[model samples]
Target: MAYHADIIVDENGKTKCGLCKVFIKDSDIYIEDHLKDTEHSDMYLQRLMIQNNIVINGKKISCLLCNQVSDVAEVLHHIDSSSHKGKMSSVKKIIEKDGGLLVLPEDITTVGSKVNCLVCDGWVEFNQEAVKTHIESAKHRRARAIVVQPLNAIFSVEGSSEDLWCKICQVYFENYIEVIFEHVDEDPIHLKNIGKLNLLIKDQNIDIEKYLHDPKEDKALCKRCGIEVPCNIDNLDRHIRGKQHLKNKK
Candidate 1:
């Protein structure tokens, strides 16, 4: 596993190196001293590769939990570890499969802009070129089909709004809000009509700020633009569809 290195300041104002997990008095030469430490340098490079999602030579995959690169055989063992599976299950509920696409629920705690592939459960590079390469991959296409087939089945089932089955929860919602917000965020098929959720929120006299402030309410952050959207799914989709988030990815 890759080591975590964060520069921390102690109560006495000493700088603590994350990887070394030790304190040194803050001084003009602190940075220089740390860089010269062999242990620090090795840990720093491993952390850098983790941050950039780079696999070292001969590595086949990176673990989703710790960002540790591993070979094909070792990767399987790492993924099966208790710690790894626990982390994977936490976000698995928020991942949905669409046609050749895996949609993730918006995460408020993410440090910076990122795009993650739910199928491989890995982070894809943020640039256009890297995103393009991932979308064209055969593995991604197969996983997407596994999710799309079932979603499309229930999507068109004829029933009363209350009787409609939620693909995520696999049960009927008591109201439209439950359908729009609760299940939609976890189901890719429901995301296609997110505008309906917005309008319902407005009609119910809810505010975007209220939603953001309250964890219980649906978030207003757009999955594509990372901005607030209008009250209708059609309008929201129109705004995001042409943008980089929904770009000719299919």
Candidate 2:
């Protein structure tokens, strides 16, 4: 497919997070100190299991990431998609777990047990202070609504309450939504196009387009050293993590 350079870059660089339910990349998402000794985060994932709207601690507010809601902000995300590699068992563990969306205190939602990042395949410490850095990483941060189905359940959610379902295809889904406004997906472009903006302010430049990958797939080009080799998605993904990119990432 002949796509715009920008779109190709966007698709290759960014993705939606099933957990946070937002569009972001490996560097955008992170863990936070909001729902530490609580189950708000985990329960939120649970409600998404089969039910459309959930009653949290007796307080019910429609989710922003569920696509069932029109206002994109109202939709919440699963957080595990970008983390877990098409792993349902891992996704299930996170869904049944608990905590909040970065900030889960005593008002917007409930809190109790803590849920771990699906990518790490581990749990966060009960203390809020504990894993603050982990919460700050791109792994736990970027969240967006997505198109997906529940893994294993006795019953299935249908119609209005359901996001997207295909009876003919024999597929049912909770209907993940897509985040409307995403900056991270456009970050690399902004960083490169506009006169390479942050070089002086942020203090570094490592030939970003070198990591620019083909969006049709996650393929990338090496424009830095001027030699074009195999800079596939995974390679480009790891390329940004080296001391090179991190040195300038503020």
Candidate 3:
């Protein structure tokens, strides 16, 4: 076979196709047979498109899977990179399961320049780079695992309900949405467990008078240390074991 730039004939007489990452028998007949395979033909067309810069600007090529941009000279390396291959595999799985990729996943929403992640209750830039960065972030992954995944499984198993559950606190609340919101908002233990609450509560929806009259009362005052700590099991344990509190005890 006439060796192209992408096809290499090693010293061992093995013919390798860089794009397909396959080794064909050293004979010209075997090489030609492999190149005629439908899969290899598709890959060859892709290589041509990349070489001609039909996917993006002439200087750079944008990956169809992950939207990563690379110089024309480095396009092959980018395509073979772990990140790009992983994204391609993931998208292929989604397409196989869903029958198509026309619809965005439920957790993601794009609005102009902003992309909202329902799982994390946060917005990122709409570009693929920013969206990918946000999806791979620790906070977003944690939220998806702890909140979205569990909720989805529960809903699928038991059917949807208005009841609220806090996985961090391991507590389930009745359908009183406002009460659940207040429970999560005022409970220092819940706040500590979640680090920060991502739920958005409007000022008008909050009962200001109720909070004013019924302020948080479960607080432990350490007279020796002159500090007040939340009256939760974890907070009390931390406070008693703290160096300042130990020094004050002496």
Candidate 4:
């Protein structure tokens, strides 16, 4: 599939993370911080699992939520405990009814320039097409309606409540993000794009600049290099402390 020029494919075919453009990877310092943290780290790992079909040796891969080493297969199940599921359900209802999409904490949603729907925990660039597609998604559409079928409250809607009997009818989910994340992380088709993006960025491809720049947003851009910093705060700190910045000071 032809993607934006920011993605570069190599002979060896091992894809890089920066190419995904879901997260930024301009600075090595930022990359390091990304590897350590939870949110982006989860996104990265999930992308890999879904895109690459990676069979994670869970013993080796630290749990994204708790930082504990768990069996790879059980990791998602472990993280999607009852409390987490309840919170997600509650947040979904709140987003649908109140329209205040604060399902996740402020820090998690505010990291990037894109408008993120915390209900789906997904993001897209700030454009009409992107926003339209996102809002129209099945997940978003399902989230738009807040309905709970009581055990005794029977209606004409045949399968509105009994998801237990029919898996396909299951609308209310528990840790849907975690499941999707794992699947996407293992998908090779997606990984190929990520790999491509990483190569182009590393080679200083100008085409990828669109993903990096957001003129209207101030916090999204870097204060030091005057360039966009896509990664987290630790990376920005490291960038400020780097030899390049140090030399400029002298």
Question: lDDT: which candidate is best?
Answer: 3
- What range of 10 consecutive residues in model 2 has the weakest lDDT sum? 145-154
lDDT string for model 4 (1-250, tens) is: 1123323335455334443434444566765555555765565445433321123563554432233455676545644657435534543454444244423322222443344675566765433345556655677755533221111011223454332111112223233434333322443643454444344334221232333232222232433345665432345446556786556556
Count clashes in each candidate, considering only residues at least 3 apart in sequence or on different chains: 3, 41, 0, 26
**Candidate 3 lDDT trough over 10 residues, lowest sum:** 200-209
Q: Write down the TM-score of every candidate.
A: 0.29, 0.17, 0.25, 0.19
> Can you tell me which runs of candidate 4 are displaced by over 4 Å?
1-19, 22-74, 101-250
lDDT of 3 at 88: 51
Per-residue CA lDDT of candidate 1, range 98-151, in tens? 233543323223333355776777766533445556765777655653444343
The prediction achieving the highest TM-score against the true structure is 1
CA error at residue 46 for candidate 3, angstroms: 2.9
Cα displacement (Å) at residue 29, model 3? 8.4
lDDT string, candidate 2, 1-250, tens digits: 1111111123556643333344433441222222221443564445443232222333344322232223222234432234222333333333333122332221223243344455454555423234455555554443312211111111234435644433212234443332111212233432243223223212223333422321122233333433233333345446555565455464
- The best-first sequence of candidates by lDDT reads 3, 1, 4, 2
Task: Return the lDDT, model 4, position 220.
Answer: 28
